[model samples]
Target: RVDGEILKGWPTPTGKLEFWSRTLHDWGWPELAIPKYIKSHIHPENLESDQIPLITTFRVPVQIHTRSANSKWLDEIAHTNPLWIHPIDADRVGISKTGDLVRVETELGYFVLKSWITEGIRPGVAACSHHMGRWKPEGHKGQRLGISTVALNQEGSEWSLTPRKGGEPFASSDPDTMRIWWTDLGVHQNLTHAVHPDPISGQHCWHQAVRICPAKEGDRAGDVSVDTGKSQAAYEKWLAMTRSADRYSPDGTRRPYWMLRPVRPERDAYHLPLKTESAEV
Candidate 1:
């Protein structure tokens, strides 16, 4: 509309570009109905003395998402998501070497990864690629260039991942699979991450505040340790932050009809049937 090509107006209910979202107010989030500043979950001020900001949003220039893991040339250049730590933070954490293994502990669990100490990253902040770290179960199919074969074991409320094998030279159809030299294809760090659903927007908060420490005994590179019980607790903690549709629906509908969906469902499907309590109760 700024270009005034057609001048039809905007898509909102008001038929104008919305500065204040009436839909959000009617749907139970009045504070966020208008454009305003909100504190980020990973704001550095919210961090404890021991914690540092973990920037997971950055990916290598060559690597795309999981699909690019199969690209041999890309994997050769950016195979691992090394923990990019600044020299000051590295020295504080007792990391004197660039390739030293470091344990990054999140709210749910911890994963060990190699630290790349450099001045590129800011002090008191560390970053790892959002890409990389693709894994497959021992018997599952995985990419040849940048995937690790691992065993996912679960016992009760505990889950553990053990690396059975990493990318290695093996004869295969492409013959490049046999030329695979890198054994460390990065770590599956996401498995240890806790869900961080936004209370109003209903989006997941990706950045995390984590504590970095020197790798302890028995901690191997790419090793991930998680307790399903803790993860469940974290899930519940984030779930409580959301305003459920059942409690906040504006017109007994699951979602706003005007919202765009790739495959739209029937209008009747949007309504939720009224529940009646049984007399036996």
Candidate 2:
């Protein structure tokens, strides 16, 4: 079967390969109706002198953190998430060698982790796999296979997590617990990440503009600090970026019906609710 013609020109409303979106134009995003690159929050012009773009968009194998049928071998292979930094950035940040602890400061706060200085990554960007930072609070029961027990503390809106210890062999019912050897399980970097939803696509933007530096005097690897208040503030900041659909639906519909909908509602249900006196409120 042909791709376009067989479907009578793609499923889109335009019935053609559209570089421009009529729905977007009528639904409050005229400038973004055409395909274009909007500067991200981490764009060079948007960043400070010491800031660099941190790419947190990718994930590692599920076995690195999540249970894979409780298979012990998968957990042994891939478990640590180190910050991938180019040698140039490494030297610039005073990371003399690999495994040196580094602090990656974000809009809300920072997380510390061992650095893996390598040429595998871009010089100007830092990357950490989101897969391996699984954690459990201090005095809380957590899986021993792929997590670090951490001390969790909170002061008003600010919160901090410090790994009390990394993975170590522990006596338990399972014999494999004694065979466990790895220590670096990774840090919880997700907490420090601020929310920034794309105005048009509505997908969460995962790229972060951050400051990378050598770990501070008291900083330990797998340490994370954040301000919940700042995280909430960031959510609102990106929320304001969106153009409200109710104000600009050309046909008073919630969204373009032509697009794929996993759970499609009745045609009439797509229309905006009747504007009552309270609707304006």
Q: Can you tell me which runs of candidate 1 are displaced by over 4 Å? A: 1-6, 139-143
- lDDT by residue (1-281, candidate 1, tens digit) is 56656666666788888988989999998998888877776776788889988887877798888878778888888888899999999989899899999999998779999999989989988999878778888887645567888888888876778777877897777877777778888888888888887876567787888999999999888888888788788878888888878999989998788877789899999998887887893
RMSD of each candidate relative to the true structure: 2.5, 3.0
TM-score of each: 0.89, 0.90
Clashing pairs in 2: none
Per-model CA lDDT versus the true structure: 0.84, 0.84
- What TM-score would candidate 1 get against the native? 0.89
Cα RMSD, model 2: 3.0
